[model samples]
Target: MTRSSHSLRTRDLGYAQRVCVAKAGKLMMQTGQLTPRARVGLAVSGGVDSLAMLAVMAIRRRIVPFPVELLLLHLNPGFDPHNHRPLVELCAGLGIPAHIETTDFGPRAFSEENKKNSACFYCAWLRRKRLFDLCATYGLTHLAFGHNADDLAATFMLNLFQNGRVDGLSSRESFFSGRLTVIRPLLLIDKPTIVRAAKAWELPVFSNPCPMAGKSMRHEAETWVRSICAGDKHRNVSLQHALGRWQLDRDALPD
Candidate 1:
């Protein structure tokens, strides 16, 4: 099927397919996105980030020499059915099979007693556990998450504020639960970049009305980062470069 052109150029990279993927593919090839005969499971929330990720990966698949099998996984952790329908339609449009795992952790779990806190930690932990279990059942070797540079930035500040140290998502991570490896291809792309790419491609999006949406202080951190980086413009690029160059002393800070 021929693809339409316009703002969606980012999603439909036909014009720049060869050049962009070649560039992105080289980085991916070095990072195991080019693993030979690997079955990869992407934890897709059907948001713009993951959708753009799938779009780019689809382009890379056509040119990357390595054989990669891709699958999409979505967890329905008690969100409105109406709110999640678009994601289902999206995977269908992309022609990728999506796995939906329903996990409504009983009522009182995040109830009146826990009103003080949103209980997002409990909810996310539950989701990850289910994702891991699904990976084991399906024999998936690698997992892809939609975490981007902005998320890493937000997390670094949050960690330092909460724990008095700097730490955040790495390009690669290992899940000890089942020896499964996880990769964040978007780690190099900032949220603004992703937004630009998504808009450039005219990709349709879904909303996340989760109970934990705006309450977190992370919003404040993101705003602060936006303000600080607004002037330098290269602020984010510099941050990624610095983090990329980091070598762990392990004992660099107090234990």
Candidate 2:
């Protein structure tokens, strides 16, 4: 569709309450994440962040100039048996195709046999591998994740404090020799904003059933970031600015 046609259609959708969707669309265009006629696979975990991502992408697909196809991929780690149903129904309401997979990654990750690895680590690894497999099987060019700005900040602190690295999550990353690109369009938005967006969009948010939900290193980092940004009104902005500067310097360095 032409730009004018796309604008008209977006106006017709009457999505004024979906400011997050517009912001996500703009971010995708700014970062060159979504190409024309791209098949995008969204990893929806039924959580607020992922559900918000799905809602925004669904709106974007309606009015984007390119012929974009969105497919939902929900991985059920058997943490909760009924968790996948809401995700499936949400996709159906949006008229998008969804693929749901069930695995024992949850139980096995926490089992004694895998005591060497953290449950979070094992579950994340398995889910990512499964996502890549799905991408290859379904011919998807790009995979979209719901890593927001808070996630980015927390990860940066986590690496700095725990791993002796200043690295954080990138908005876009490539894997398998650039065969599949992973994009995080929500990298520019914060968690509170995403929560508000989820509410405004009426996303079906599901609670994570992981026993280690609020006790990981990431959680500690999140608490630290929040406390640092608590009293100072501009602390969050300063951190974001610092991250941007660091990214520029990092990009300019040798590979």
Candidate 3:
């Protein structure tokens, strides 16, 4: 039985539909990512990637496998809480509940770190901790981040050169401390997919400068990736494909 997006409530989708919230709902099912009844706690930073993923997941709720009930969790580590309003509006328009919270990750902590290295490493580490804590508080089992394939590839290369690791971000990981599972549904998608989808769907962009945007190494990497993509078109897509194929050929490469 086929169902349109109009027929879905917050609880109709099954497990298979939860992780592959943006792609064909059956992808995860066919791959056995989840059973028939999984719930996902999505993290939305009010960015194009996160917003795009949110909209896609909303549409996916009317799908099969598992109904993904999105609980928008926003953590203001150093970014403005007001900067997240667009996400609130987007959720409201989508008729989903969005929650906001602020953590006192003092500005000093970020400023001090920004001097030696990009602010992202420290800030992101903290935000992730906050996000995980929120998931535990809400009793949400699976937590999703909006990291697309582009991010994975860039980070992988960056880590290879800088961190001496062959890993970037894992598709599915269990938080070492909390053992909470984290996933990336959009890991196969890229910035173009996100940008086009956000514009096409009119996803609200939260106007906030992540305190370490231009100064962060990941942001720098993103800029570099975009610059190269602008000059040579295939760099972006090729990297994305490489990531997927690499994972397929060797799901667990010895690190």
Candidate 2: tens digits of C-alpha lDDT, residues 1-255: 322123323444334325667767766776677888889999988888898788778778877787999999999888887777776656666778999988888898989868778888988899999999999999999999998878888999999989997798877677889888898877767777788766656666888888988998899999999999998868998896677545534433234
Of candidates 3 and 1, the better by lDDT: 1
lDDT of each prediction vs. the true structure? 0.64, 0.79, 0.63
Higher-scoring candidate on lDDT, 1 or 2: 2
What TM-score does each of the candidates earn? Answer: 0.80, 0.88, 0.78
Query: Candidate 1 residues 1-255, lDDT tens each?
Result: 213123223444544333433544544554544467777788877688876776666555555677777788877666655555665655666566778765574232376755554477666666778888888888888888877667777777777776688687766666776468787766656566677666555566677756667765777667766776787868868876565445122212234
Model 1 spans with C-alpha error above 4 angstroms: 1-26, 105-109, 112-118, 247-255
**Alpha carbon deviation, residue 67, candidate 3 (Å):** 4.0
Residue-level lDDT tens digits of model 3 in 83-185: 6655555666667776687765536456654576445556667777788777878777678778887887778777876788787666666565644667666
Q: Where does model 3 exceed 4 Å of error?
A: 1-27, 30-34, 106-108, 111-118, 176-179, 223-230, 249-255
Which is the winner by lDDT between candidate 2 and candidate 3?
2
Per-candidate count of clashing residue pairs (backbone under 3 Å): 4, 0, 8
- CA lDDT for candidate 2: 0.79
Using TM-score as the measure, name the better of candidate 1 and candidate 2. 2
How much does candidate 1 score in TM-score?
0.80
